[model samples]
Target: GFKIGGAEVSRKHAGFIVNTGHATARDVLDLIAHVKRVVKAKLGVELETEIRVIGDL
Candidate 1:
């Protein structure tokens, strides 16, 4: 339940991370990476995404 780069892993939905402010691409990426790392390490699940990344952070 931590926030990374101003993005949060939704408590209601593990699949979504919402930007709480003026978060850029890098912010979301950093949050996603952190989330993946933590989730994989703690839960033994690998996260794969089809989400597209656009613009520079």
Candidate 2:
């Protein structure tokens, strides 16, 4: 599992990022961005988010 702040990419599921504790919206968003970047860089694939983010980013 990869952790950034209180957000983590679940060890059991690569596609799921969960809040360990006290995770803010920014933390989740940052982690998502990180995953996208890594996937693109390593696998030459572009990932698109299935969820829509609302509110200030």
Question: In model 2, what is the error at residue 35, expressed in angstroms?
Answer: 0.3
Cα lDDT of model 2 overall?
A: 0.93
Give residue 27's lDDT in candidate 1 (0 to 100): 78
Pick out the ten consecutive residues of candidate 2 with the lowest summed lDDT: 48-57
- For residue 6, model 1's alpha carbon misses the true position, in angstroms, by 2.2
Top lDDT prediction, candidate number: 2
Q: How does candidate 2 fare on TM-score? A: 0.94
Per residue, candidate 1 scores C-alpha lDDT tens digits across 1-57 of 468777887888988888888766777788889888988999999989769876655
For residues 1-57, what per-residue lDDT tens digits would candidate 2 score against the true structure? 888899999999999999998888999999999999999999999999988998886
On a 0 to 100 scale, what is the lDDT of residue 5 in model 2?
91
Worst 10 residues of 1 by lDDT: 48-57
Error of 1 at 32 (Å): 0.6
Relative to the unseen true structure, what is the C-alpha lDDT of residue 56 in candidate 2, on a scale of 0 to 100? 83
